[model samples]
Target chain A: MIGRLNHVAIAVPDLEAACAQYAGPLGAKVGAPQDLPEHGVTVVFIELPNTKIELLYPLGDASPIASFLEKSPAGGMHHICYEVPDILKARDQLISDGARVLGDGSAKIGAHGNPVLFLHPKDFQGCLIELEQV
Target chain B: MIGRLNHVAIAVPDLEAACAQYAGPLGAKVGAPQDLPEHGVTVVFIELPNTKIELLYPLGDASPIASFLEKSPAGGMHHICYEVPDILKARDQLISDGARVLGDGSAKIGAHGNPVLFLHPKDFQGCLIELEQV
Candidate 1:
Protein backbone atom coordinates (compact mmCIF):
# COMPACT_ATOMS: atom_id res chain seq x y z
CA MET A 1 0.00 0.00 0.00
CA ILE A 2 2.66 2.49 1.05
CA GLY A 3 5.19 3.37 -1.59
CA ARG A 4 8.32 5.46 -1.08
CA LEU A 5 8.75 7.65 1.93
CA ASN A 6 7.38 10.88 0.49
CA HIS A 7 8.60 13.48 2.96
CA VAL A 8 8.82 14.00 6.70
CA ALA A 9 6.93 17.01 8.08
CA ILE A 10 8.23 19.07 10.99
CA ALA A 11 6.22 21.77 12.72
CA VAL A 12 8.24 24.88 13.45
CA PRO A 13 7.42 27.95 15.44
CA ASP A 14 9.36 30.12 13.01
CA LEU A 15 9.76 28.94 9.46
CA GLU A 16 12.54 31.37 8.58
CA ALA A 17 14.67 30.30 11.52
CA ALA A 18 14.22 26.68 10.62
CA CYS A 19 15.09 27.43 7.04
CA ALA A 20 18.24 29.25 8.09
CA GLN A 21 19.26 26.33 10.28
CA TYR A 22 18.90 23.85 7.45
CA ALA A 23 20.37 26.11 4.82
CA GLY A 24 23.40 27.18 6.82
CA PRO A 25 24.46 24.30 9.03
CA LEU A 26 22.76 21.36 7.36
CA GLY A 27 23.77 22.91 3.99
CA ALA A 28 20.51 21.88 2.41
CA LYS A 29 18.88 23.57 -0.56
CA VAL A 30 15.82 25.11 1.00
CA GLY A 31 12.94 26.19 -1.18
CA ALA A 32 10.95 29.37 -0.84
CA PRO A 33 8.24 29.40 1.80
CA GLN A 34 4.84 28.50 0.42
CA ASP A 35 1.59 29.34 2.13
CA LEU A 36 -0.76 26.38 2.01
CA PRO A 37 -4.05 27.96 2.95
CA GLU A 38 -6.01 24.80 2.44
CA HIS A 39 -3.74 22.96 4.83
CA GLY A 40 -3.61 26.02 7.12
CA VAL A 41 0.17 26.22 7.25
CA THR A 42 3.08 27.79 5.40
CA VAL A 43 5.65 25.24 4.33
CA VAL A 44 9.20 25.15 3.03
CA PHE A 45 10.72 22.12 1.39
CA ILE A 46 14.37 21.32 2.05
CA GLU A 47 15.55 19.35 -0.93
CA LEU A 48 17.45 16.23 0.00
CA PRO A 49 19.02 13.60 -2.20
CA ASN A 50 16.58 10.79 -1.47
CA THR A 51 13.60 12.74 -0.05
CA LYS A 52 12.47 16.16 1.16
CA ILE A 53 12.08 17.66 4.60
CA GLU A 54 8.99 19.84 5.02
CA LEU A 55 9.06 22.68 7.51
CA LEU A 56 5.58 23.78 8.58
CA TYR A 57 4.28 26.80 10.45
CA PRO A 58 0.72 27.72 11.34
CA LEU A 59 -1.13 29.94 8.90
CA GLY A 60 -4.39 30.58 10.72
CA ASP A 61 -5.81 30.52 14.21
CA ALA A 62 -7.70 27.33 13.42
CA SER A 63 -4.64 25.60 12.03
CA PRO A 64 -3.93 22.21 13.55
CA ILE A 65 -0.24 23.05 13.60
CA ALA A 66 -1.13 25.98 15.79
CA SER A 67 -2.51 23.62 18.39
CA PHE A 68 0.43 21.30 18.00
CA LEU A 69 2.73 24.25 18.64
CA GLU A 70 0.65 25.29 21.61
CA LYS A 71 1.39 21.99 23.26
CA SER A 72 4.95 21.57 22.10
CA PRO A 73 5.91 25.26 22.09
CA ALA A 74 9.39 24.35 20.92
CA GLY A 75 8.03 22.85 17.70
CA GLY A 76 8.34 19.16 16.77
CA MET A 77 7.79 16.58 14.12
CA HIS A 78 4.24 16.78 12.81
CA HIS A 79 4.03 13.70 10.62
CA ILE A 80 5.80 11.41 8.17
CA CYS A 81 4.31 10.87 4.72
CA TYR A 82 4.55 7.82 2.50
CA GLU A 83 3.68 7.76 -1.17
CA VAL A 84 0.92 5.50 -2.46
CA PRO A 85 0.02 4.44 -5.96
CA ASP A 86 -3.68 4.88 -5.31
CA ILE A 87 -5.15 6.92 -2.50
CA LEU A 88 -8.72 5.59 -2.62
CA LYS A 89 -7.64 1.96 -2.58
CA ALA A 90 -5.30 2.60 0.29
CA ARG A 91 -7.96 4.49 2.23
CA ASP A 92 -10.54 1.77 1.78
CA GLN A 93 -8.11 -0.93 2.79
CA LEU A 94 -7.07 0.97 5.90
CA ILE A 95 -10.69 1.67 6.90
CA SER A 96 -11.79 -1.89 6.36
CA ASP A 97 -8.87 -3.04 8.42
CA GLY A 98 -10.13 -0.90 11.37
CA ALA A 99 -7.78 2.06 11.04
CA ARG A 100 -9.33 5.47 11.52
CA VAL A 101 -8.77 7.88 8.68
CA LEU A 102 -8.86 11.49 9.77
CA GLY A 103 -11.02 14.35 8.37
CA ASP A 104 -14.25 12.82 7.08
CA GLY A 105 -12.32 9.84 5.72
CA SER A 106 -11.82 11.48 2.36
CA ALA A 107 -8.78 12.33 0.31
CA LYS A 108 -7.74 15.96 0.04
CA ILE A 109 -5.24 17.72 -2.20
CA GLY A 110 -1.96 18.05 -0.35
CA ALA A 111 1.11 20.28 -0.70
CA HIS A 112 2.41 18.24 -3.61
CA GLY A 113 -0.86 18.79 -5.48
CA ASN A 114 -1.65 15.13 -4.90
CA PRO A 115 -4.47 13.35 -3.17
CA VAL A 116 -3.58 12.73 0.45
CA LEU A 117 -5.17 11.19 3.53
CA PHE A 118 -4.15 11.34 7.17
CA LEU A 119 -4.45 8.35 9.44
CA HIS A 120 -5.19 8.89 13.10
CA PRO A 121 -2.14 8.88 15.34
CA LYS A 122 -3.82 6.57 17.83
CA ASP A 123 -4.37 3.87 15.21
CA PHE A 124 -0.76 4.08 14.04
CA GLN A 125 0.85 3.93 17.48
CA GLY A 126 1.03 7.71 18.06
CA CYS A 127 2.51 8.63 14.71
CA LEU A 128 0.36 10.62 12.32
CA ILE A 129 0.68 8.78 9.05
CA GLU A 130 0.03 10.66 5.81
CA LEU A 131 -0.41 8.76 2.60
CA GLU A 132 -0.01 10.79 -0.57
CA GLN A 133 -0.85 9.54 -4.03
CA VAL A 134 2.17 9.77 -6.25
CA MET B 1 25.54 14.96 3.60
CA ILE B 2 22.48 12.80 4.14
CA GLY B 3 22.15 9.91 1.73
CA ARG B 4 18.61 8.69 2.27
CA LEU B 5 15.94 8.52 4.86
CA ASN B 6 16.83 5.26 6.57
CA HIS B 7 13.71 4.99 8.71
CA VAL B 8 11.18 6.83 10.78
CA ALA B 9 11.18 5.74 14.42
CA ILE B 10 8.00 5.55 16.49
CA ALA B 11 7.97 4.88 20.21
CA VAL B 12 5.19 2.47 21.03
CA PRO B 13 3.94 1.39 24.41
CA ASP B 14 3.47 -2.27 23.47
CA LEU B 15 5.82 -3.76 20.92
CA GLU B 16 3.80 -6.92 20.26
CA ALA B 17 0.47 -5.11 19.83
CA ALA B 18 2.03 -2.62 17.45
CA CYS B 19 3.55 -5.42 15.43
CA ALA B 20 0.19 -7.19 15.20
CA GLN B 21 -1.52 -4.03 13.99
CA TYR B 22 1.03 -3.47 11.23
CA ALA B 23 1.21 -7.09 10.15
CA GLY B 24 -2.53 -7.77 10.18
CA PRO B 25 -4.24 -4.56 9.12
CA LEU B 26 -1.47 -2.64 7.41
CA GLY B 27 -0.23 -5.79 5.69
CA ALA B 28 3.37 -4.78 6.13
CA LYS B 29 6.38 -7.12 6.24
CA VAL B 30 7.26 -6.76 9.90
CA GLY B 31 10.64 -7.99 11.06
CA ALA B 32 11.44 -9.78 14.29
CA PRO B 33 11.97 -7.73 17.40
CA GLN B 34 15.60 -7.00 18.34
CA ASP B 35 16.78 -5.79 21.71
CA LEU B 36 19.54 -3.15 21.85
CA PRO B 37 20.82 -2.99 25.38
CA GLU B 38 23.00 0.02 24.67
CA HIS B 39 20.08 2.08 23.35
CA GLY B 40 17.81 0.55 25.99
CA VAL B 41 14.97 -0.23 23.57
CA THR B 42 13.40 -3.18 21.81
CA VAL B 43 12.65 -2.50 18.18
CA VAL B 44 10.93 -4.11 15.21
CA PHE B 45 11.26 -2.87 11.67
CA ILE B 46 8.37 -2.82 9.22
CA GLU B 47 9.74 -2.92 5.72
CA LEU B 48 8.07 -0.82 3.06
CA PRO B 49 8.84 -0.55 -0.60
CA ASN B 50 10.78 2.69 -0.37
CA THR B 51 11.84 2.75 3.26
CA LYS B 52 11.30 1.20 6.68
CA ILE B 53 9.32 2.07 9.79
CA GLU B 54 10.91 1.35 13.17
CA LEU B 55 8.71 0.59 16.15
CA LEU B 56 10.43 1.07 19.51
CA TYR B 57 9.49 0.17 23.06
CA PRO B 58 11.23 0.58 26.38
CA LEU B 59 13.59 -2.23 27.27
CA GLY B 60 14.28 -1.22 30.86
CA ASP B 61 13.22 1.24 33.54
CA ALA B 62 15.87 3.75 32.50
CA SER B 63 15.01 3.50 28.80
CA PRO B 64 14.50 6.86 27.07
CA ILE B 65 11.36 5.52 25.43
CA ALA B 66 10.00 4.90 28.90
CA SER B 67 10.36 8.58 29.68
CA PHE B 68 8.87 9.57 26.34
CA LEU B 69 5.94 7.19 26.95
CA GLU B 70 5.43 8.62 30.42
CA LYS B 71 4.86 12.01 28.86
CA SER B 72 2.91 10.92 25.78
CA PRO B 73 1.42 7.69 27.22
CA ALA B 74 -0.12 6.82 23.85
CA GLY B 75 3.20 6.47 22.02
CA GLY B 76 4.39 8.77 19.23
CA MET B 77 6.95 9.43 16.55
CA HIS B 78 10.30 9.50 18.29
CA HIS B 79 12.89 10.28 15.65
CA ILE B 80 13.82 10.18 11.98
CA CYS B 81 17.02 8.64 10.66
CA TYR B 82 18.93 9.81 7.61
CA GLU B 83 21.78 7.91 6.08
CA VAL B 84 25.11 9.68 5.82
CA PRO B 85 28.03 8.61 3.71
CA ASP B 86 30.54 9.22 6.50
CA ILE B 87 29.40 9.40 10.09
CA LEU B 88 32.52 11.21 11.32
CA LYS B 89 32.34 13.85 8.62
CA ALA B 90 28.67 14.44 9.23
CA ARG B 91 29.26 14.72 12.96
CA ASP B 92 32.07 17.21 12.58
CA GLN B 93 30.09 19.34 10.13
CA LEU B 94 26.98 19.38 12.31
CA ILE B 95 28.98 20.28 15.38
CA SER B 96 30.86 23.01 13.57
CA ASP B 97 27.52 24.40 12.49
CA GLY B 98 26.41 24.49 16.15
CA ALA B 99 24.10 21.49 16.36
CA ARG B 100 24.41 19.56 19.57
CA VAL B 101 25.23 15.93 19.00
CA LEU B 102 23.63 13.78 21.67
CA GLY B 103 25.52 11.39 24.00
CA ASP B 104 29.29 11.59 24.35
CA GLY B 105 29.78 12.83 20.79
CA SER B 106 30.61 9.40 19.47
CA ALA B 107 29.00 7.05 16.99
CA LYS B 108 27.61 3.79 18.33
CA ILE B 109 26.81 0.63 16.41
CA GLY B 110 23.07 0.66 15.68
CA ALA B 111 20.62 -2.15 15.03
CA HIS B 112 21.66 -2.43 11.36
CA GLY B 113 25.29 -2.79 12.50
CA ASN B 114 25.91 0.72 11.20
CA PRO B 115 27.47 3.65 13.04
CA VAL B 116 24.85 6.11 14.28
CA LEU B 117 24.79 9.48 16.02
CA PHE B 118 21.84 11.38 17.43
CA LEU B 119 21.24 15.13 17.32
CA HIS B 120 19.49 17.04 20.05
CA PRO B 121 15.85 17.78 19.34
CA LYS B 122 16.11 21.36 20.58
CA ASP B 123 18.66 22.23 17.90
CA PHE B 124 16.58 20.71 15.11
CA GLN B 125 13.18 22.21 15.94
CA GLY B 126 12.25 19.58 18.53
CA CYS B 127 12.52 16.60 16.22
CA LEU B 128 15.21 14.18 17.31
CA ILE B 129 17.36 13.51 14.30
CA GLU B 130 19.62 10.50 13.80
CA LEU B 131 22.34 10.14 11.22
CA GLU B 132 23.48 6.63 10.40
CA GLN B 133 26.59 5.89 8.41
CA VAL B 134 25.51 3.80 5.46
Candidate 2:
Protein backbone atom coordinates (compact mmCIF):
# COMPACT_ATOMS: atom_id res chain seq x y z
CA MET A 1 0.00 0.00 0.00
CA ILE A 2 2.57 2.55 1.15
CA GLY A 3 5.84 2.93 -0.72
CA ARG A 4 8.48 5.43 0.36
CA LEU A 5 8.31 8.16 2.97
CA ASN A 6 7.63 10.90 0.47
CA HIS A 7 7.95 13.87 2.82
CA VAL A 8 7.17 15.08 6.32
CA ALA A 9 5.37 18.41 6.33
CA ILE A 10 5.87 20.95 9.09
CA ALA A 11 3.57 23.91 9.37
CA VAL A 12 5.52 27.01 10.33
CA PRO A 13 4.26 30.40 11.34
CA ASP A 14 7.30 31.90 9.69
CA LEU A 15 8.24 30.02 6.56
CA GLU A 16 11.44 31.93 5.79
CA ALA A 17 12.87 31.34 9.27
CA ALA A 18 12.06 27.68 8.97
CA CYS A 19 13.78 27.51 5.60
CA ALA A 20 16.83 29.30 6.97
CA GLN A 21 17.09 26.81 9.86
CA TYR A 22 17.25 23.87 7.52
CA ALA A 23 19.48 25.50 4.94
CA GLY A 24 21.91 26.94 7.50
CA PRO A 25 22.39 24.61 10.46
CA LEU A 26 21.03 21.49 8.81
CA GLY A 27 23.14 22.13 5.73
CA ALA A 28 20.31 21.07 3.46
CA LYS A 29 19.36 22.35 0.03
CA VAL A 30 16.20 24.42 0.29
CA GLY A 31 14.12 25.06 -2.79
CA ALA A 32 12.23 28.19 -3.67
CA PRO A 33 8.88 28.66 -1.97
CA GLN A 34 5.91 27.88 -4.18
CA ASP A 35 2.35 28.81 -3.41
CA LEU A 36 -0.47 26.40 -4.20
CA PRO A 37 -3.67 28.36 -4.02
CA GLU A 38 -5.75 25.24 -4.42
CA HIS A 39 -4.21 23.78 -1.30
CA GLY A 40 -4.00 27.21 0.31
CA VAL A 41 -0.40 26.68 1.32
CA THR A 42 2.95 28.14 0.43
CA VAL A 43 5.58 25.40 0.67
CA VAL A 44 9.32 25.08 0.46
CA PHE A 45 11.07 21.77 0.03
CA ILE A 46 14.20 20.93 1.98
CA GLU A 47 15.92 18.17 0.05
CA LEU A 48 17.64 15.43 1.99
CA PRO A 49 19.55 12.39 0.90
CA ASN A 50 16.71 9.91 1.36
CA THR A 51 13.61 12.03 1.90
CA LYS A 52 12.35 15.59 1.79
CA ILE A 53 10.93 17.91 4.45
CA GLU A 54 8.17 20.29 3.42
CA LEU A 55 7.89 23.59 5.25
CA LEU A 56 4.38 24.89 4.86
CA TYR A 57 2.72 28.20 5.71
CA PRO A 58 -0.87 29.26 5.42
CA LEU A 59 -1.65 30.98 2.13
CA GLY A 60 -5.06 32.39 3.07
CA ASP A 61 -7.60 32.54 5.85
CA ALA A 62 -9.35 29.48 4.46
CA SER A 63 -6.17 27.45 4.48
CA PRO A 64 -6.27 24.42 6.76
CA ILE A 65 -2.86 25.31 8.08
CA ALA A 66 -4.33 28.52 9.42
CA SER A 67 -6.55 26.62 11.78
CA PHE A 68 -3.73 24.34 12.75
CA LEU A 69 -1.58 27.34 13.57
CA GLU A 70 -4.33 28.81 15.67
CA LYS A 71 -4.30 25.73 17.86
CA SER A 72 -0.53 25.66 17.88
CA PRO A 73 0.78 29.19 17.65
CA ALA A 74 4.34 28.09 16.81
CA GLY A 75 3.09 25.62 14.22
CA GLY A 76 4.02 21.94 14.33
CA MET A 77 4.25 18.69 12.47
CA HIS A 78 1.27 18.84 10.14
CA HIS A 79 1.36 15.56 8.27
CA ILE A 80 3.43 12.68 7.01
CA CYS A 81 3.26 11.73 3.34
CA TYR A 82 3.78 8.24 2.07
CA GLU A 83 4.13 7.35 -1.59
CA VAL A 84 2.08 4.67 -3.33
CA PRO A 85 2.56 3.23 -6.75
CA ASP A 86 -1.10 3.46 -7.68
CA ILE A 87 -3.22 6.27 -6.32
CA LEU A 88 -6.61 4.85 -7.37
CA LYS A 89 -5.89 1.38 -6.07
CA ALA A 90 -4.61 2.70 -2.77
CA ARG A 91 -7.57 5.04 -2.40
CA ASP A 92 -10.04 2.28 -3.08
CA GLN A 93 -8.31 -0.09 -0.75
CA LEU A 94 -8.20 2.50 2.01
CA ILE A 95 -11.86 3.41 1.50
CA SER A 96 -12.84 -0.22 1.60
CA ASP A 97 -10.98 -0.56 4.87
CA GLY A 98 -13.06 2.22 6.45
CA ALA A 99 -10.58 5.02 6.06
CA ARG A 100 -12.10 8.41 5.30
CA VAL A 101 -10.50 10.35 2.51
CA LEU A 102 -10.49 14.08 3.28
CA GLY A 103 -11.82 15.56 0.05
CA ASP A 104 -14.44 14.37 -2.41
CA GLY A 105 -12.92 10.88 -2.34
CA SER A 106 -10.79 11.87 -5.29
CA ALA A 107 -7.09 12.58 -5.67
CA LYS A 108 -5.88 16.12 -6.18
CA ILE A 109 -2.62 17.46 -7.59
CA GLY A 110 -0.33 18.32 -4.69
CA ALA A 111 2.63 20.61 -4.27
CA HIS A 112 4.84 18.19 -6.14
CA GLY A 113 2.41 18.04 -9.02
CA ASN A 114 1.48 14.49 -8.00
CA PRO A 115 -1.85 12.99 -7.14
CA VAL A 116 -2.42 13.10 -3.40
CA LEU A 117 -5.19 12.27 -0.95
CA PHE A 118 -5.46 13.06 2.73
CA LEU A 119 -6.80 10.57 5.24
CA HIS A 120 -8.78 11.81 8.18
CA PRO A 121 -6.73 12.31 11.34
CA LYS A 122 -9.23 10.46 13.47
CA ASP A 123 -8.98 7.41 11.24
CA PHE A 124 -5.21 7.47 11.57
CA GLN A 125 -4.99 7.96 15.35
CA GLY A 126 -5.06 11.75 15.19
CA CYS A 127 -2.20 11.89 12.75
CA LEU A 128 -3.12 13.34 9.39
CA ILE A 129 -1.67 11.00 6.80
CA GLU A 130 -1.26 11.86 3.15
CA LEU A 131 -0.77 9.35 0.38
CA GLU A 132 0.83 10.56 -2.82
CA GLN A 133 1.28 8.72 -6.09
CA VAL A 134 4.93 8.49 -7.02
CA MET B 1 22.56 16.64 8.97
CA ILE B 2 19.68 14.21 8.63
CA GLY B 3 20.52 10.95 6.94
CA ARG B 4 17.14 9.45 6.21
CA LEU B 5 13.69 9.25 7.64
CA ASN B 6 13.86 6.51 10.23
CA HIS B 7 10.27 6.68 11.30
CA VAL B 8 7.21 8.82 11.91
CA ALA B 9 5.67 8.24 15.31
CA ILE B 10 1.97 8.51 16.05
CA ALA B 11 0.64 8.53 19.57
CA VAL B 12 -2.46 6.34 19.85
CA PRO B 13 -4.83 5.87 22.74
CA ASP B 14 -5.20 2.17 22.04
CA LEU B 15 -2.04 0.55 20.75
CA GLU B 16 -3.69 -2.65 19.61
CA ALA B 17 -6.46 -0.86 17.76
CA ALA B 18 -3.93 1.26 15.96
CA CYS B 19 -1.90 -1.82 15.04
CA ALA B 20 -5.00 -3.56 13.73
CA GLN B 21 -5.81 -0.61 11.48
CA TYR B 22 -2.40 -0.62 9.83
CA ALA B 23 -1.99 -4.38 9.68
CA GLY B 24 -5.46 -5.12 8.44
CA PRO B 25 -6.58 -2.26 6.24
CA LEU B 26 -3.22 -0.76 5.35
CA GLY B 27 -1.71 -4.21 4.66
CA ALA B 28 1.44 -3.27 6.51
CA LYS B 29 3.74 -5.58 8.44
CA VAL B 30 3.28 -4.58 12.03
CA GLY B 31 6.00 -5.49 14.49
CA ALA B 32 5.52 -6.70 18.04
CA PRO B 33 4.97 -4.03 20.67
CA GLN B 34 8.10 -3.12 22.59
CA ASP B 35 7.96 -1.38 25.94
CA LEU B 36 10.53 1.27 26.65
CA PRO B 37 10.25 1.90 30.36
CA GLU B 38 12.79 4.66 30.23
CA HIS B 39 10.78 6.47 27.64
CA GLY B 40 7.55 5.56 29.42
CA VAL B 41 5.94 4.33 26.24
CA THR B 42 5.06 1.13 24.42
CA VAL B 43 5.65 1.25 20.70
CA VAL B 44 5.03 -0.92 17.65
CA PHE B 45 6.62 -0.45 14.29
CA ILE B 46 4.73 -0.66 11.04
CA GLU B 47 7.20 -1.41 8.35
CA LEU B 48 6.84 0.16 4.94
CA PRO B 49 9.05 -0.23 1.89
CA ASN B 50 11.06 2.89 2.62
CA THR B 51 10.43 3.87 6.23
CA LYS B 52 8.67 2.70 9.36
CA ILE B 53 5.70 4.14 11.25
CA GLU B 54 5.90 3.88 15.02
CA LEU B 55 2.65 3.50 16.91
CA LEU B 56 3.19 4.79 20.42
CA TYR B 57 1.05 4.37 23.54
CA PRO B 58 1.47 5.44 27.09
CA LEU B 59 3.26 2.87 29.21
CA GLY B 60 2.17 4.58 32.42
CA ASP B 61 0.50 7.71 33.72
CA ALA B 62 3.85 9.45 33.63
CA SER B 63 4.31 8.80 29.96
CA PRO B 64 4.55 11.83 27.72
CA ILE B 65 2.16 10.18 25.33
CA ALA B 66 -0.35 10.22 28.17
CA SER B 67 -0.34 14.02 28.17
CA PHE B 68 -0.37 14.20 24.39
CA LEU B 69 -3.42 11.94 24.34
CA GLU B 70 -5.06 14.13 26.97
CA LYS B 71 -5.10 17.08 24.57
CA SER B 72 -5.87 14.93 21.55
CA PRO B 73 -7.95 12.12 22.98
CA ALA B 74 -8.01 10.32 19.66
CA GLY B 75 -4.24 10.47 19.44
CA GLY B 76 -2.20 12.07 16.67
CA MET B 77 1.21 12.56 15.19
CA HIS B 78 3.81 12.48 17.96
CA HIS B 79 7.17 13.05 16.34
CA ILE B 80 9.36 12.45 13.30
CA CYS B 81 12.66 10.60 13.56
CA TYR B 82 15.44 11.20 11.10
CA GLU B 83 18.56 9.08 10.90
CA VAL B 84 21.87 10.80 11.33
CA PRO B 85 25.29 9.31 10.70
CA ASP B 86 26.65 11.02 13.81
CA ILE B 87 24.27 11.89 16.58
CA LEU B 88 26.86 13.95 18.48
CA LYS B 89 27.66 16.05 15.46
CA ALA B 90 24.06 16.58 14.68
CA ARG B 91 23.31 17.53 18.25
CA ASP B 92 26.15 20.01 18.35
CA GLN B 93 25.16 21.56 15.06
CA LEU B 94 21.53 21.83 16.07
CA ILE B 95 22.40 23.34 19.44
CA SER B 96 24.76 25.86 17.91
CA ASP B 97 21.97 26.92 15.60
CA GLY B 98 19.75 27.71 18.66
CA ALA B 99 17.88 24.45 18.67
CA ARG B 100 17.22 23.04 22.13
CA VAL B 101 17.76 19.35 22.61
CA LEU B 102 15.38 17.78 25.07
CA GLY B 103 16.10 15.55 28.08
CA ASP B 104 19.48 16.78 29.26
CA GLY B 105 20.87 17.15 25.77
CA SER B 106 22.16 13.60 25.57
CA ALA B 107 21.32 10.58 23.47
CA LYS B 108 19.30 7.67 24.78
CA ILE B 109 18.93 4.13 23.47
CA GLY B 110 15.76 4.08 21.39
CA ALA B 111 13.53 1.18 20.37
CA HIS B 112 15.91 0.33 17.50
CA GLY B 113 18.76 0.23 20.04
CA ASN B 114 20.20 3.34 18.45
CA PRO B 115 21.39 6.55 20.09
CA VAL B 116 18.56 9.02 19.79
CA LEU B 117 18.05 12.59 20.88
CA PHE B 118 14.86 14.65 20.77
CA LEU B 119 14.73 18.32 19.85
CA HIS B 120 12.21 20.70 21.39
CA PRO B 121 9.09 21.29 19.34
CA LYS B 122 9.25 25.05 19.83
CA ASP B 123 12.66 25.25 18.20
CA PHE B 124 11.56 23.37 15.11
CA GLN B 125 8.29 25.13 14.41
CA GLY B 126 6.54 23.10 17.09
CA CYS B 127 7.55 19.80 15.54
CA LEU B 128 9.21 17.44 17.98
CA ILE B 129 12.08 16.03 15.99
CA GLU B 130 14.10 12.96 16.93
CA LEU B 131 17.56 12.39 15.57
CA GLU B 132 18.81 8.81 15.67
CA GLN B 133 22.31 7.65 15.05
CA VAL B 134 22.00 5.04 12.36
Model 2 residue B10 lDDT score: 92
Model 2, range A50-133, lDDT digits (tens) per residue? 788899999976999999899999999899998988999999988888889997989999998899999998888888889999
Clashes of 1: 0
Categorize the docking of model 2. Answer: medium
lDDT of 1 by residue, A1-134 (tens): 57678899999998889998888877678999899898899999988777888999999768999999999988998998988888899889888888899989889999989999999999888889999999
lDDT by residue for model 2 over B1-134, one digit each (tens)?
67678888999999888998888877788999999999999999998877888999999769999999899999988998888899999999888878899989989999999999999988888989899999
Candidate 2 segments whose C-alpha is farther than 4 A from its true place: none
Model 1 Cα lDDT, one tens digit per residue, B14-116: 8899999888866678999999998999999999876788999999768999999999898999999988889999999989888899989999999999999
RMSD, every candidate, angstroms: 1.4, 1.4
Candidate 2 yields a Cα-based lDDT of: 0.89
Q: How far off is residue B63 in model 1, in Å?
A: 1.1
Candidate 1 global lDDT: 0.90
Task: List each candidate's DockQ score.
Answer: 0.69, 0.77
